[model samples]
Target chain A: MIGSWMTLPLVLVAAPPPPLDPDPRASPPAAAVEADPKAEVPPLPLRDARRAEQAPPPDVMRAADNPRVPKAKPGPPFYDAADEAVFRARFDLTKDPAPPPRTVRMRCLVADPLCGITVEVQALSAYALRAQQGSVATANARTWHSARAQYDVWVQFPAVVRTIGRTRFNVLSMGPKGGIVASDGGDLWANVGLAMRAFFGKGAFAPHLEVTGALAFRIGGFTEGGAGFFGAGRTDLGPVRSPVGFAMDIGVGLGGFGSLVIGGQYDSPLAREEVPESLRTPAAGMFYVGFRGNILWGAPAAAAVTTHVLAGRLVVPER
Target chain B: MRAGVRPLRGRAGVGYRVHAVVILPLASVLLVASLASPAAGSEAEAPPRTNRYLEAPPSSAPAGEDFGPFFTGPPASETSFVKAPRRGSGLAPRLSVRDGLFCFVEDAHCVASLLASTDVGIGMAIIGENGPDLPYAQLTFRGGFSLRPVTLYRKRYHPWALGLTASYSVGTGGIRLQAEDVVETARTQATRIALVNQLWLWHRPHAFHLDASIGAVRSGVLGRDERIHDLWGTHVELALGFGGWASLVVSGDFLDEDTRIVFGFRTHALAGVPVAGLTALGLWAGGVL
Candidate 1:
């Protein structure tokens, strides 16, 4: 028991000091012990172990500080914080928390060919970076710098190609109840035409209009050589271009696919001398209705539809 | 009075003949040739206009890198261990079924689906005739088939396409009265049949089409007299399909003294095909322009 008591004092004296707090966030002890002014400084953790290991010995450190001592090639290790600071200054490594230099591409709004600008944006957030890029693409899309010529086609209905008119064109010539005129010189006539179309709307259904002009070929009524309605067999009165024919249509456009339309047409009276004054009747008017459909080219709706069909998406999917 | 009228009639007849034989034909030929010249020219002569929306997205690859190196096989030493006999027959038919039948959707300007590129459609128009009574209207049914032949200055745009078109028109009633209508009477119906060969020109197939055709017509079906006549025709067609599926046609048909105008529509030949439809859309958008 006497010997144990004697050794306890020695053991107490030999015990090592407790380790400093590993976490910097921990508060210091309230009753902090004042550090000795002349005591050797405690070594710091290896924040930069490489530079620490390369630290010169005391004598070399002192020699490095003294310019009088001729230094070897590549010089000596940094002797103090000031020396390290000076070295870092030369290499520009002292700047702390340094992030990579941010960069962005910019362009002029006036469509200048040499307007591309590389901007060194500093400290932009992730969201900001994306916004920058997206805006650039938008600008590019809106800019006319790379604008190319564009052309689009207009399709109209009842596109008129030719026209002719004859007062008795269809009345006395080619009617269903026409056997009354037996003479070969009786009134008979024919007219031909072509048309065009137009549209003014969007989507699968829209309003449309069509105008047509007739291409008149055979237009005069047959001349009656004999007297009455029961004269000789019918004879052609020959072709004439006196009257005019026209047709118009208005209805809904079927999304460039075709049209659901209602239309009417008219052929004017023949004003030619071929027909006798008695046989010359007023212009024959005819009206008919039907549905016509057509395809559209270079239409935005076409592109959207194609994308949807092929990829099952209205827009091209991002990779 | 008769002598005075005779001289006037003679002058009028001479003028009409001159106009028909010279001025009219000359004008028609000039109009068609002028419209078709651009399509006949080489693509290089008139490069397609660029479209901003069609530009390719910007690439992020590094500059000056040789892509060839990436595609090349590894060193011979590494490949030596994998040596094996070639499996496929060395001689294979040059044209594959896929090449003839299919097309890539992204490539709008390619003519890869030639085998299925023939256009066929049916059309209708109103016909007018001077019958025994007031002017009457009749319905005309038309069926057409067309094929594009190879052109000298061909490129992706295919602005100019020389085509052979065969068409048949069935006219009922009117000027050519229906045989049934004339059966009760002493008269016979004069039905007409016509065929056409067309030359097509445009920036894109779906954009515009200017065609001039010459064919033959035969008239007087079920009639006492059957007459055959030479024919000529012209057409201005525009494709208004947003989907590039159909086109509107304005056509003129002339058979001797008879002339007719018709408005019609034609659906794209390959519209029903799987990938070719996309190609049609591309071509309509001025492929690669």
Candidate 2:
């Protein structure tokens, strides 16, 4: 009899219920956390309120747009606030998100070099990077197919400029205008020449001045161009004064702003000819040390593809 | 072979020619400098912001483009400073037809020719512009091949070609100059060799391809007097391309008294014949290859 009763209970458990509503419905789905790429999100206003006592209702959090999870009572944080503060301190830009970024670090992120989209994320990450600066995220630059315009550069912050020599940048920034960071965004001696790779990989035209000297030898009977910034250090105009010489040069180039340049030339006496005729001298080409800034303006050689990626870490415990 | 015109009687102290090197250029540069603001203070402090914060992540890519983890950045709008200008170049052989307007400033003459390719090519400078000098210096066409056995520097895909150009010419430029005509005839049958460097400079706004070359050209000429002299000289050419198919070329043969500069500033179709139909001091049209 006891066995039959147990069997009867088992049968009861196995029996299926009568049909009710045909459609299935979720009890309360959670909202996804992601920002739209094209969402013109208004700035999150700064709040200086004290920590709240009550946590937000779970239902409200699950349904509300632009929801904010209330903070727990002021107790020791889940992790070291000081350590997080130090990490945050490491990043100057992790401050309030107003129109113009406050911290110089954030300024660079918003202005040149780093993309501004991740400022909020970076703000949160300032705390997480405390342990692993290595986990930092990076984006690659677009590729330049043209060789002429593919000069890239990474300018160190606070560039050092000197006379007739030396070179240097901060964070893949094409600090062509020297390392000086201006609020209005202009630099002196803007960095240029000698390409440095960008965060994203693509090459940016440098705005810095570049001076170069190159030796050219004609194959069998090699020759060079004459009279301009684009010209070498020789002039072979014509017969009576076919003055040829070794080239000495001082050239200056403007990077991204405008690819303008001036190259001065002075051929070694080894190339200048002084062939004198009876009463008159052939036009031996005036200005034995001629310089060419002939190239007034040249179009930007390559395309600039600005690539920005949003990646970083934020630490929080499950409610 | 040719003679010289005495530098204008008595007044010759580096006159107008000096303008090409000094004076005007200096004045122009100064004018530009006067208009420009002195370089702003070197170390720029971030703009003084009374209220500054991160503007939202521009919501999307700073430029207007669909977002993918990795894709080409935004296309520059018409007003954007950056642009995309592709340099047009290929392995396809260019069949160029050219006309050389020789001694336009001094003799008012021209030559016509046709040439094709990096390998075997030919040119004929047989066209005439003004008639006064054709009879004295009839034109000739020549053909040959480029012995470009090596390349100097190549980046990405653009190659710097160091070529050995060799050719043979059989034509007439035997001059019969009168006491009054200030003309130097370049008529000869000669062997030519040149070192040619074809470099593509920039690829934006308009592509600028530069064909800079220097070479030796030797010609054996028998004058009307039955006297023979081997004309020897070297020349250089600068061809800057503003298009994928056309370039503004300025070329001249040096070591010759009657050297005339050839200028080709004509437009061209990337797939069609490239021609430079105008002349300054040399020929109206340069090589048509």
Candidate 3:
């Protein structure tokens, strides 16, 4: 008993001093602490820790000195200290919650965006001193797509020689029942067309050909006046201005006419661009073999017709 | 086996002219008789205008361009993939098939399937005789309409299409099909309704198109022991052609657990009309009127 009493005094003196309260709400009044200037003050846990590890303290005023922030002015104590009791009582007693979620900034490299693509640069959250960059990969994942801009340069390549010119065309005139018709020589008809084709794989694709099937359209019977109540009289038509629709099909050592172009074209009735009220019969589904080389270039020839009427085949209405 | 797939496609022979001779007269007579009826009547009054120069030239339009319009502008130098819209319309021969044999769905006996011609006309296909499995079946005949009414494309190179077909086939043979539990045997006629989705890859230089379609097929038999088989079928086709208006087609079809392939060649300017189409199956020829 005598020895225990002797060591108790020494053990109590060696123990560490109790830590100060870190929470502002748990702190005593400033006046009360001011009276004891020598008392050690508690350090703000989250605010000080994050600041020390991350960046320099913000340049803007802190919550304590900011004019915009509410001060502890004695009267009415901010919340009728009477009615807001429960709401205020439930508030957390921690210093500065988690750091604010990162704010992002986006920038582009070019203004006009040439070479066929638009590029964007963004700056994510980072630590200045440590020079650590935040992740941006997830957000940029969905930026690529089929509609994205593209650039291509054609390079000359040697390709095998192959025969060109082998398209079939049906040029026929139908009377009321699709028989041979000779009305005023069956309304003399002529067709001239031109097309510009961008060949892809060199030789064969040098001029892309457009292929179409029958009038897969069921317009509810526009020509039902035919024999036995036949439905559609016109064959299904594709575009009249296929990239390579009209070629220089000059008959050299062949049996075909000098000008052979079998494609869909519209003259009037189906015109979608010009004056809407113009209801002329659309010259569609006719297989025409133009022997005249009156028109040499294709673009002007195509523009000549397309400008007047719709390209007979299948085309979307103008926006 | 849809009507618009491939019906009569195979290794073509040198009988290109012979094929045309047989179908020409038949088509002419039929067309003449049909024309004897009356001019087709339309609800609208305006006549179809075939003249592109009907209107006087505008100051800027590229009309009266008699010589050469070659070497155009910006569109020429810049190269990009083609992007086509949905809902495209096109016409083909009356009796064309993309793939999946019509007769193969039931017998795969006497005849092979016909490939749908890219041309616009009417056609027929008939194959005589069959294997021992369908001894009674003397021949098979099928005909119908095939159309590609809806088409979508990502680029000119990647084309997608939806095909609608309605066709009828008659096989004069005993339906010798032994299912898991039931056995069916009898002579009957079959009708097929099919919708197929197609993917077309274009080989620009050769003017070649490689296409494939897959979809649902319903083969319905009309007879005493009528039955229907619902299944999926696929068809693949390779077409080669020169620019302008002529092409050779070879296609393969797999339907009703059987495979059939056919070949054909089409010429545009021939025998009076602007277009002439000939098929190897029934040796039929039809042209646009």
The recovered share of true contacts, given per candidate in order, is 0.00, 0.00, 0.01
lDDT of 3 by residue, B69-95 (tens): 211111111222111110100011111
Each model's TM-score, in the order given? 0.26, 0.23, 0.22
- Over 4 Å off in model 2, which ranges? A1-319, B1-71, B76-155, B166-191, B204-206, B220-228, B255-260, B265-289
lDDT of 3 by residue, A161-220 (tens): 222111111111110000000001011111122122112222111222222122111111
Return whichever of 1 and 2 wins on TM-score.
Answer: 1
lDDT of each: 0.26, 0.23, 0.22
Q: Give the DockQ (2 decimals) of all models.
A: 0.01, 0.02, 0.01
Candidate 1 docking: what grade?
Answer: incorrect
Name the regions of candidate 1 deviating beyond 4 angstroms.
Answer: A1-244, A247-267, A276-319, B1-140, B151-165, B170-205, B221-289
Identify the superior model by TM-score, candidate 1 or candidate 3. Answer: 1
Q: What is the TM-score of chain A alone in each candidate?
A: 0.23, 0.21, 0.14
Scored by lDDT, the top model is: 1
Question: By how many angstroms RMSD does model 2 differ from the true structure?
Answer: 29.4
Clashes of 3: 67
Model 2 reproduced share of reference interface contacts: 0.00
Q: Could you tell me which 10 consecutive residues in candidate 2 chain A have the lowest summed lDDT?
A: A119-128
lDDT of 2 at B243: 24
